[model samples]
Target: MSRKRLYLRAGLYAEGRSDYDFLLPLLNRLLSSLASSLFPGACDVEDSLGIDAPYPAPSERAERIAAAIADRRAECTLFVIHADGAGDPRYARQSCLDPGIDAARRASPDVVTVPCVPVRETEAWLLVDAEVFRPWLGSDAHSALPAEPEREADPKLTLGRLLKVKEGRMRRKPERLYRLFGEEVSLEALRALPAFQLFEAELVEAIRAVARSQGWPR
Candidate 1:
């Protein structure tokens, strides 16, 4: 029998430019991890941001998803959309993500869609592991980190304050910090979060579907 190698290509539709910086690396890692677990043989995972096409208006989320699918359908096996829960995870999923996913699938039947709705904001997920950013804080700053970041009304603001303290009056840009968090934050800590777990489950199912279609044994 000829050896089979699985090659997975993923595309991302991030909510913001900074979101791409964070989510691209994070998605790549997550997909690689999941692919390795599901495929015993050699596996390769590659990802790209769906930036070839312009996004529609923020309110036209379903259109945006359809556009992304149209743009990357040929090159990508899976498409992940990142949307901040913005204080109401259920509403975000029901009002924004589900409609978008449905439209994308309807428009491009071959496209595999995955929703990544981080509760409150993507920053909340970054806070899952304080150790990732603790070293950047000043010694005098002694404020306790939020015990439940998803419940925090504005995790981005909280993270901004910490980064400001670390950089003093210079006002550090958060994009680098987000990238750092994406690279180093512990997957175990993220898995403990309900929102992350939901994403993982959906992502795994999508990958399984792709594998089945490709005639790969799961």
Candidate 2:
């Protein structure tokens, strides 16, 4: 049986971390779980961001990622997932998603660019496989990390019904208060919040769509 190699790029902020650190693990868990659950012999997914190199420009980033996909030398598909609408000059001046898709198509024409709905919405994608990652929170998931939150309330209140309860009850919901709290909240915020369940479901469906398009190996 010929094995296809799948390559993924986690984008700029994810550079120096091990797969166990951040988004990589979340994505890996989803893909591996899906593959194991549905297809025992599907293509093996590998991340090439481990190359220990400087961050490339948008086009260069696409090229470098494309080169890695090409080097796999197997019938494969490459998916590049990134955060869009970050107010980055490059993404604003030129379409990062389009160029990436074009670059990957240069190799397989099947390459996919799965940009987050928006920069802020990236929290949704990062948390797509969060259920499997709660253990990493260690002890209290709420206090996994401490910050000087602008709001006096426990930051975890941002999670779901609590958010409504806290903000809705506030006599004066300060704009700065909400914005500052948002900055401190991690991707875990989405996982713990009920409002984002739909986003998480969308990510799972998108991933499954890609996998299915690739022809899941039975």
Candidate 3:
């Protein structure tokens, strides 16, 4: 049997980091923003698969997730949920958040939940980081840049192609792209994207709310 893991100061949840590479850095950025006043100790995210299997039967899914979390209730203070906006982000993200919140509550009623679903997909937010894209574009960064990345229909495809331009034959696999963002890209550049804005605002507020509850200054 696995030893009982002592609880950390906090934690986060995402669908699959390998499948959605950008989300990890994005989540980390939020932690950086909140670390000083909100999460003083190390706070990290784990793929939800560790808690429950991917998309179990609808009837059993929530119960399974709740049970899993209850079994490991000591590992987190709250769980920030990461998902994609399959159709309409505002509406679609809730599909995951509602159930996730319920599941977390089963483990601890006070668990705070923050939901993020980049418009269309998280890749959509990356496209908006034109400062980083400029390096890839060489001379065409200004001209090749899309003015409305959020309006794009298939951002994942668009991002994959853009990444290839920087790397001749390499695909936008998780490690490669995540490395670029972590080591090369400028986080400030992404603030222009609406998806990032939403995430920033929601995360700031969530952290503030938690701070208030803990009687920490806002």
- State which candidate has the highest TM-score: 1
What lDDT, from 0 to 1, does candidate 1 have? 0.78
Model 2: per-residue Cα lDDT over 60-170, one tens digit each: 655654554454425333343443334342463256445544665687765444433233323222333323234343344444332322221322233322223343553
TM-scores of all models? 0.88, 0.42, 0.72
lDDT at residue 82 of model 1 (Cα atoms): 80
**Angstrom error at residue 203, model 2:** 5.6
Which candidate model has the greater lDDT, 1 or 2? Answer: 1
Model 2 residue 69 lDDT score:
48
| Cα lDDT of model 3 by residue, 1-218, tens digit | 85322122334455666433455555555455555445545333333223333354336545654654554556544455666787588786667667756866766877666677777776666665556766567777656756887788888787767767433654455566764664444566667777777777777776666556656555
Clashing pairs in 2: none
Task: Provide the lDDT at 78 for model 1.
Answer: 84
Q: Candidates ranked by TM-score, best first?
A: 1, 3, 2
Candidate 3 global TM-score: 0.72
